[model samples]
Target: MALDPQAKALLDMVYRVGAPRFHELDVAQARHSFEKLQFALRPEMPAVASVTDVPIPQARAADGVIMARLYRPLSAGPDEILPLTFYFHGGGWCIGNITSHDVLCRELANHSKAAVLSVDYRLAPEHPFPAAVDDALRAVQWSLANAGMLGIDPTRFALAGDSAGGTLSAVTALAQRNAQGPRAALQLLIYPSTDILSQRPSRREFANGYMLDTGSLTWFFEKYLPEEDDWQDWRASPIRAARFDGLPPALIITAGCDPLSDDCKAYGEVLREAGVPVEMLEFEGMVHGFITLGKFFSQANEAVLQAGEALGRAFAAGGAS
Candidate 1:
């Protein structure tokens, strides 16, 4: 498919601006740049019933705590026990945070009619490989244990995120599936980097001109996984996992122009082949990271609504064990 007009315009504007790309910046600069784009282009925040910041105690004593933001939809009653989605923000596991994804979370909560918890996991470069994975696992574990106190339904809980955040969601869901006790009912992966070792056609096709360029991806990987061997770990690359059986049902979203598009599709195929229910949605002509730029792309809003509806259906179906 040809590039969507809106996406092309966005790309043109980005190139016209002559700003340094992520690969050219330091970690702090990259983060600031990412935040600026999100702030400038994200849709207006949708109203929610309540928003709360909750601290998740770390499993390791030296790791301190993970912070998360909870959003309850306006449709939800104050005392209602709504299903919850644990969201991890995408920034190649290094840049994005809860604040950057606040509006997206609000939109999801309002549309899905489910509470959304946006986890602020540890970033990379400072805390490299496995640290983000550890925080993701710990946050979900803590939330499950305290679901009652948080006024969420443990039985209907799911996991969700975009890009690197999506990778974490998949990894976390996989980890939870094998462990005794509660497992996620659904896994919503949006243009996730499922395979760090992927050499897919999309990666080559969209390598340079797409919003998420090859250089930036390399920069992210270098920061997140200084040790190249860690890239093979299933926690780092869920597509590298030995099996996809027993994982929760999945809703995989992909942007046709994204380098990770093939990764998302391949992961969905793997899940389906393993007998896991899989629903795949591809927004043809869209670029990577377009879902968060609703102000500029109409498809972003449509995609969010679709995602929310999918979550609502899963929740109503009582979710998988």
Candidate 2:
């Protein structure tokens, strides 16, 4: 399918404005550009009951602290303990922070009637590989252990993220499974990159012109991977894992024109084969990262509502629908 009209228009505008590609800029410059682009694309912040910041100390933080933001919808009562969605933002694990995903998190919280915890994990080049993974798992453990203080219902927890964030969610689930740790009710993966080694057809077919290009992916991976061999590690690439059994139920979202579409589909198939319940939604004509640009892409809003519905069902009593 061709790109959606709004997605195409946005791409045209990006090119016309001569925006620098991710691969062509330094980390700081790339981050600034990414934030600026997100700022222009996102709609006004939606009204949520409340948004607050909490500090999470990592496994070995000398003086640094991982930041997390919690979003609660108006429907949530002051004393009520609600299901929590621990979210990670996408920027190839190199860029993107809570601020860039603030509005989307609020929307999810509002629509799902669930508390959303957005993690600002350590970034790449400076922190590299297992660092983000460590922070991700730690955040989940922290959330579960400190549920009461955070007003979270420990029994009803979900892991959600986009792009690189989605990758972390998948990896964290696998880690928890192996450790017999806190289980996530559902894993919400949006246009995620599952296989670091496999070069799927979508990667070649939509490698250029799309908002996320092949070169940019390479740049992001280079920034995140500690060593070349780390690419094959299951924590870095969940597709390379020997077993997908016992992982959480999955709600996978894929964009028709995204380079990572095939990656998400293949991952979903693997999960289903391993006896994990999976629901995959492919938004035809949409490109990667469309979910974050609701102001420009009508499909973005639809996708968010769909995600909320999925969360509602998964968090409902008696498990997945």
Candidate 3:
């Protein structure tokens, strides 16, 4: 199948400008470029009832605090304790932050009718390896413990993210699957990198012209996990986890043209085999990050609607429990 016309046009324009690929720049420059591109490509921001910034303090002052931006849906009642999605934005664990993903978070909140808390976890190269993982786990824990303060329904909490952030969301579900730990109602993964080291067919099939090139993937991995051994760590690659038996149900979304398409499919299948209910959707003709480019892609809204409906179902089930 051919690439979506909009996707192809965006790629053509990007190449025509000769914009430096992410792999061509140093970490700082790459981060700046990524944010600029995000701002330029994303649609006009949707309205949410309210958005507030809150910081989750770390035990060590040196580690710094993680910031989260909260989005309350326009339709949510003032006194209602809404279901919540604790989201992490994707930038290969190196770039992206609350500001870079602001619009997407608003859309998710609006469509899901759930409060969204987008975590600004520490990036790599500076934080590296377990730092992002640690911060992500901490954010989920903090959200669970402080649900009342945040005016969210603890019982209907879920984890959701894209790309590296999606990886983090999956890893968090595995990390907190204890009897005493907070149980996530759902795990919504968007084109997640499950097996960081696995060279699935899609990695090569769509490696070059797709929005997320192999070179950029390599660059991100090199910056975030300099040690080759880090790729095998289950924390870094959730697919390597000892078990997925008790993890929450999942809705894994992939783009057929994404380098991670097969990886996501594999993850979902393994989870299903382990008796965890899983639903995987591959949007043929779409590219990685299609869900964020609503201005150019109608499929973006379709994906969001699907995700929102899934989230709603999970929340309702959680409430029933």
Top candidate by lDDT: 1
lDDT for position 152 in model 1? 92
Q: Write the per-residue lDDT of candidate 1 for residues 219-288, one digit (tens) a residue.
A: 9999999998898899999998888888989999999999999999999999999999999999999999
User: What residue runs in model 3 are displaced by over 4 Å at the alpha carbon?
Assistant: 178-180, 319-321
lDDT of each: 0.92, 0.90, 0.88
Ranking by TM-score: 1, 2, 3
Per-residue lDDT value at 107 in model 1: 95
| Cα lDDT of model 2 by residue, 279-300, tens digit | 9999998989889988888889
Q: Write down the TM-score of every candidate.
A: 0.98, 0.97, 0.96
Q: Regarding lDDT, does 1 or 3 come out ahead?
A: 1
lDDT of candidate 3 over 168-205, digit per residue (tens) = 99999998884357678899999998988888898889
Q: List the residue pairs that clash in candidate 2.
A: none
RMSD, one per candidate, in order: 0.9, 1.6, 1.5
- At residue 244, candidate 1 shows an lDDT of 86
